[model samples]
Target: MAVADTRHDDTVTCMAARLLRDAPEEFALLGTSMGGYVALEVIRQAPRRVRALALVSTSARADTPEQVASRDRQSRLVEAGEFDSLVDAAFRGLVAEQHEKDLALLDIWRAMARTVGAAGFLGQQRAVVGRADARELLSTITCPTVVIHGADDRLIPIEMGAECAAAIPGAEYVVIEDAGHFLFREQPKATASAVADFLGRVDTSH
Candidate 1:
């Protein structure tokens, strides 16, 4: 699978969307969180190219004023060379309450944060702050789509994922119990099962 580069560009969403120009003529698209925003942008920019879609723990609405301020604060923290502090602060919101002390999951998050670096994180924050509201675009989607959300997500609530699914005709809505924003990491087997089932159906239909 080809992963799009979300670093180095201040317009991270647009940059990642542009990368789809190089993707196969048609392919399934799966995205989580900020990547989901990028996926919606991809749908806007090239609707005909997507064969199927899976959006995990993401929202179709644009960032709220409070969210924008939070991103700005995170950017400032990175600018002040407090990247670890920023990551630490965000850790609680990334997982279920029971998984708050899951060292293995935290380690994975920390490693990903280090790989993304301060600059990359800052760019992504900026991009998220400026992303478009994709609610209207959902109804236009004709491809098979699935919306997966953590039942206990503290980040984007499950209601938002349900809204996305409701807007898209024939879209499937899945809620993973005992999970939070990082449901894929918290409940990998269930999350993967849902995705595998969706993809399996998509393949069979074609």
Candidate 2:
């Protein structure tokens, strides 16, 4: 359950993948959002090491032109010392319509953004912007995999998660209803159950 630092490098997701070079000989990998992008790169770099994988709230395709432009604008805003404002704007897009007024959630999210700071966010933005299309690599994934997405996700569409499952042989796909980009936060029990069930099956199979 070790977390990889995806913010240290600003150039590519490969840098983040390298952080796992000294990880256990074989381990299960789980990632959300940009973390999922890094997880895919890890699979690409060392498929044999991952016994199982869970990709949550992420896309296999690279960023669209519009998405790239949006991220660029965000980076510019951060550079101009408008990080707080940028976080505020992004908060709306990170959750479902129902959570727009979730003040507690907003506070927690804001705190996380502040902890990451402007530089880290900029680095993450650049790495995401430069990430490769992972669709081609999906077919090559022989390890057990699970793709979990939120039914009400506003960030990465649920279709993308379905696409990942469809492409990866024997992959399990679970969509948590009423959940959004932050599905784990929105429906922690459901999210945890799905992941635990998938991993339990993987463990039993192994």
Candidate 3:
């Protein structure tokens, strides 16, 4: 199983298709945040290639105006060479209240942001802001789907995950309390355990 990471929708979709064409029988998708969005798009484009899906801290709607504006501001800040502060501001809502003071996780997130840089951030923001509503696409998804969200996620509200699960027949939803948007980083043990359990069920059922 390979993990395909790309910020742009077209690139992600194309890569997913290529992967599916090259090795149709061996891949289970697990994506977080924007990657989750890409994963959903892949499922839409090539449902037969996917065995199971794990959607974490993601939404089915395009970015709100406020979010777009915030992204614009972050882009400007990044262009102005205030990358550290921009990363810190961007990741503020990702970590839980308790882990807000955890410098280690903050540093890791900051490093990730800096590594992506301004151009990548702007491009990703544009992709997110211009994305189509995935609610309709959810109903067409027939694979064993697991939707994971943080109870304290400020980015995409937990209700969105609930709604996604409700819309998709037999989709499982899990909310990790005290976790934020960055559930994998903030609560890795619990997140991994939940994902493992979901995968186990998927394997048994299939």
Distance from true position, residue 104, model 2, in Å? 1.0
lDDT of 3 by residue, 90-178 (tens): 67778776778889898889788877766777677666666667888888888888999999988788888888888887899999988
C-alpha lDDT of residue 39 in model 2: 86
lDDT ranking, best first: 1, 2, 3
lDDT per residue for candidate 1 within 104-141, as digits (tens), equals 99998999899999888988888888888889999999
Residue lDDT tens for model 2, 125-177: 88999999999999999999999999999899999999999999999999999
TM-score of each: 0.96, 0.96, 0.88
**Model 3: runs farther than 4 Å from truth?**
7-26, 204-206
Q: How high is the CA lDDT of each candidate model?
A: 0.88, 0.88, 0.77
Model 3, position 171: C-alpha lDDT score = 91
- The list of candidate 1 runs beyond 4 A from truth reads 204-206
Worst 10 residues of 3 by lDDT: 5-14
